[model samples]
Target: MSAAAPPVSSRLFSLFCLASYLLSLSYGSTFLLSLLIGSRGGNELDAGSVISAAMLSTFAAVIVSGHLSDLLGAARSIALFSLLLVVASLGFALTPGFGNLLLFFGLMLGLGWGVFYTLGPIIVASLVTPAQRAKYFALLSGSMMTGIGSGPLLGRAASALGYPVTAAFYLAALASLIGALLFWRLDVQLKKTPSASASVARISWHATARVLSSRAVFPIIMVGLGGCVFGGLSSFQTSYAASRSLDYSLFFFGFMGAAISSRMLIAGFVVKRDPLRASCLLSGLMMVSILMFGFVVDDGFSYVLAAMMLGVGYGLTYSVINGLAANEAPSGTTSQSLLLFSLSYFVGVFGFPLLAGRIIVEHGMVTLLLTVLTIALLNWLITVGRLIWRHVSRIKTLQQA
Candidate 1:
């Protein structure tokens, strides 16, 4: 048998985690793009459309960048995407109108995010053994959550200081530039200490089909549902807060706090021990959180509580489902499986917001919340079903033996 892969360097891993944090910081700051749209005399629909356009770009980018990562290597592909994000963030700050320019910049931002998010887990998977995957994944995600959670606060600080909300985009640009440089350094290190698992190979359509049809389907579907819930909640948060007469920042704070804490504390322990069962429990929590947000939240405390519930539920659930996808992937198709997983998530995260915007403009925030709750319920049911199926299959094998 081939020798076990060498341990990942502590310095290299630290660089990777820091780069992920900075890149996500940039992404999280753009969550305030709705504020910019409102300031420019545009409505929810405009913001949704622009965000949707970006998601569409993200979809395309995930596909292209996956192939490029396989061709050019992960660090180089990530560095290139980081530069694109820098350009988009700068464009958002400099551009005046909320029309084509906004959409173009949004697309650029999506492209950058799509590549970074897809490659991040793949890199972690390559560097670590199967047993260590969940722990490292949690660490990486925690770093990302910290950055994402801090972004809205940064925007709020900018606004408080009488600067335009778009000023956050300038900070985002700076962060992206730094992240790009770090990734470049990572590329140099990778060359000096090449990983055996990091061999460059073209992705085949045959492998892609196998991954989609394999057990990977379960996690992909679950993550997509989680993305839908997240996309709807986040994209329409400003409107929801207005309707509740609450502060939007509370939601971000609660979510960020809960997500980071859960990932850092419980993700490795829970996800490694029967990911499907953990996913089912988390999905139930997610459903309850959505219900609280929709029907039970009447005060700031309730709202923050609801957001925290969602943070733990969806946050841990995502890490669990991601591990499932990576672990369950067919041989020689880990990259393809992750690419599809990212694509499914982008569809829900970006695609649903487009519809949610119109729903809020025409129907109302209540209707939107109700719709999101329904999606969460479906997600829970899927996990429960998968768990049951696994249990029954094991019983059948035992009996036959």
Candidate 2:
């Protein structure tokens, strides 16, 4: 057998966490892009279309960047993407009008986020041992969630302080520039460590297809559904809150607070105990939370509660499902599995917003909520089905013996 991989140094891991925070902070702030579009005389459909176009670009970028990371190295790929993010953010801040140019900026944003998120776990996975993966992933996720959560609050603060909401884009640009520099430094640091495994070999297309078609399908589908719920909620949040005359910050605070807390405190334990069962339970909570948000949330208290419920449900479920994807990856296809997992999620997170935006414009927020609720239900059913399938498979093995 080959020599064991070197353990990731605490300093290196800390740096990774910081960079992740900055990158996601940039992304999270852009959650206000809908508001930005509104300021530019665009409506929900325009915002959704722009954002959806970005997601499509992200879809393409994830595929390209995953291969590029394997070929060029993760740090370099991330740094390059960070620079793109900086450009995109600045474009949003400096550019005038809401037209096709916004779509171009959206593409740039998608490409940047696509690479940063996809390569992040791959880098972490390589550095840590299998035993350390869950804990480290959870910690990394917390940093990311914290940044994402902080972005909106920063915007709210900016607006309250008499700054234009578009100022958030400028701040996002600065964060991306700083993150790029740190990642560049990381690349130099890794180059000095002769034993560092900074990149993986590229797998064949056929091998990739096989892995995606296998047990990886479960996590892919679940994460995609989760993405749909998240995209629908976040992308249209400004409009949704307006319809009810509620403050949108509550949703951000409640969702991010609960998500970050659960990932840090309880995610590893829940995943360890029984991932499938945990997924089923959490997804059910997600459905209920959506229902509450749709039907019951009229005031701040109820809205915050629903947001928190959705946070815990979707947040923990994401962690658990991610673990399942990694665990169920066949043989040497771990990287491919993770890449596909990210892609599937991008489809839901980015793709659904386009449809959801139209739904809100034409049908109404209630219809949109019902659609997302159905997705959550489908996600829960899949987890339950997977659990039953596993039990049946075990029983068949026992009978054969």
Candidate 3:
């Protein structure tokens, strides 16, 4: 006899809660790291490089975890990774020195995050019917936005309360532990990996190669480009606000709030209708928002308005792309398709920031935002062009028939 699995709704609710909590922990930790690193004799470039390294590590881990999750099962893999998340958070909170920060907080924490992120979607796709994917993913995105929105405020409150940095980190660590325990409690197993020899499982080159050649690559590229826009914002917004004497916490709050609202209210409608069109529209809006940031420096209200636009654009784009990538997964290769999707975003997150760091350090955030705006426009054009080409081909085929 086996234990009964929890209802899909319950399991989804648990996952959603976990996603929210973990994202909060992540955003708060990043904010703390920027301040801590700067106070300890590092600069903006150092912080950017550190964040880039973390995202790069996540990219690597996601590639490997996809195969591992398929082999060990998503629930089991999530439970295992959640423990790493807990340990890493505690280590980050307790350890001192730059080397330790890079090791525990950057690399170790990233590995855990990569696994959790990849497996969460896999499990969600398995649990729900296809029709429900867009809606549920929107909810999941909303939950993440909620976390992102609150994380900065949590940090600000802790700072205002004169809490020791150590205490603040401890709270984040506790949240990770709770998330781990929740994942451990899930009883769902919607699909099992095909049995294979240990050696075959060890070498996943075949799976990687197959996914690279599949149709999912288009969405993967699109998502990666979209990530470049948000990655720049995430890595620099706080620093940018600080440089301008603006309240970063309030601005981030506005950004995340708009993001959550957009995902909850608009993501499903857009994604369900046509992913490519949504991608183009959202990408264009992101471009406009980034451009707006350049001019809104003096006015706090304008700054907040720009942040809201950025939030809504990024929030909607993120979930829409994820759902599209998941739906594009081929038979027996869902995990691999998802790997490509995750890998692309992290690539953008890592590469964009790392490249923009030099510009930020040299010229200014104004120059960086303009550069990012160009990239965003290119991404939008590419996606829209593809959609137009696809439509043209379909019409030609119909005429021939």
Best by the lDDT measure: 1
* TM-score of every model versus the real structure: 0.95, 0.94, 0.87
- Candidate 1 wrongly placed segments (more than 4 Å): 1-3, 193-196, 200-203
Clashing pairs in 2: none
Q: Residue 107 of candidate 3: its Cα lDDT?
A: 70
lDDT of 1: 0.82
Q: Which parts of model 2 are misplaced by more than 4 Å?
A: 1-7, 191-198, 201-203
Which 10 consecutive positions of candidate 2 have the poorest summed lDDT?
A: 194-203
> What is the lDDT for 230 in model 2?
87
Clashes of each: 0, 0, 0
**Local accuracy of candidate 1 as per-residue lDDT tens digits, 354-382:** 88889988998889889999999899998
How far residue 163's Cα lies from its native spot in candidate 3, in Å, is 2.6
lDDT of 2 by residue, 1-401 (tens): 12466766789878988988888877787678778888888877887887787777877776787578767788988998889889888887787878888788889988998888888877777766665666777777778877877777777888889999888888888988999989988987766654555565354688678787788779988999999998889878878888999988898999988988787678768757777888899999999999998889999999999989988998777777776777688877777777878888888987898899889889998999999989888988998898899999999999999
Model 1: lDDT of residue 372 = 94
> Candidate 3 overall Cα lDDT vs. reference?
0.68
